[model samples]
Target: MSAPPLSLRWRRRDEPLPAVAVAASGAVVTQLGADALMRVTAGAHLRACVGREQSWLVVLGDEADLPWADGAVYLGWDGGLLVPTLAQPWPCADLLREPLRRLTKQQTGLIALLPELVLAGPLPREPLDPARLAPS
Candidate 1:
C-alpha cells in the first residue's frame, strides 16, 4: 500500500519543457519527491526536498503562464529542476482535494512527497522502473 513513484524531467533552461497533463480546472499536483507531495496552492510556491540534496519547487500564481493541452502537463526549468508554473489561481482547499498523480516523462527519474518536513528518511532502496508508472 505504498504511494506510487513520482516521475520527474530534468531540463536545462534552453531545452523544451515537458507539458503537464492538467484537467480543465488548471490544477495538478505532481509527485516529485521521494516521500513528499508538493502542492501548488493558488498563490503559493512551495519547495519540497527530495531524497538528500535534491528538491522540487512547485510554483502556482496569477502571473505564471502554464501551457495546457488535452492530456499533458508541461513544466519549465528555473535554472534548476523542472517546474510546473500554473497561470490560473487554484484554492488551497480545492488543491488538497485533487488527487496527486505520478508525474512522468519519456525518460526521467521518479520521486514523491511526505507529510512531515522533519521526516527526512532515506528514499526507498529500489531504483524506480519507469515502465511501471504512467507517462505524463
Candidate 2:
C-alpha cells in the first residue's frame, strides 16, 4: 500500500504530545509542512512528534537527545535512512516510522537541528524520579 501523504503540524513549546485520539483522526489540525517544525531542548524546549495516517507532529532537537530505543528510528545527518527492527507492536510508531524516515532523509535540513559539536552536552540519562515517568 502507498504511504499516506506526509505533512507536519508544529506544537507549542508548552503543548504536550498529541494523544492517541489525535493520531486516530478524531481531532483536527490546520498547519502543514515538510520543514523542521521547532527546536527541542532539555530545559526550555521539550518537543515530540505524533504521526497518524496523514500528518506528523514533530520537534527538531539535538540528535543526542533522541534515544535509539526499541521503537525509535533515527534519521541520519548524512541523509541516510535507518530502519529499526520491528521488535514490538508499536502501531502508531510503526505507522509513522518509515514516513518520518523518508521525510527526514529527503529533507536533510532537519538533521541540522543537532549541532556539529556540543560542548559538554547533556548526556542521555534516565530520569532520577521514576514515579514522574509513569503515565498519569
Top-lDDT candidate index: 1
| Ten-residue region with minimum lDDT total, candidate 1 | 110-119
Q: Which candidate number has the best TM-score?
A: 2
Tens-digit lDDT string for candidate 2 (1-136): 9877444332222323221111111122122111112111124222333333333322224443432222223332222212112112223333544555455553331211111211111111332222221222
| Model 1 per-residue lDDT tens digits across residues 38-75 | 12323223332222222222222222333223433344
Lowest lDDT block of 10, candidate 2: 112-121
lDDT of 2 at 69: 25
State every prediction's TM-score relative to the real structure: 0.18, 0.23
Q: Assess each prediction's global lDDT (C-alpha) against the native.
A: 0.27, 0.27
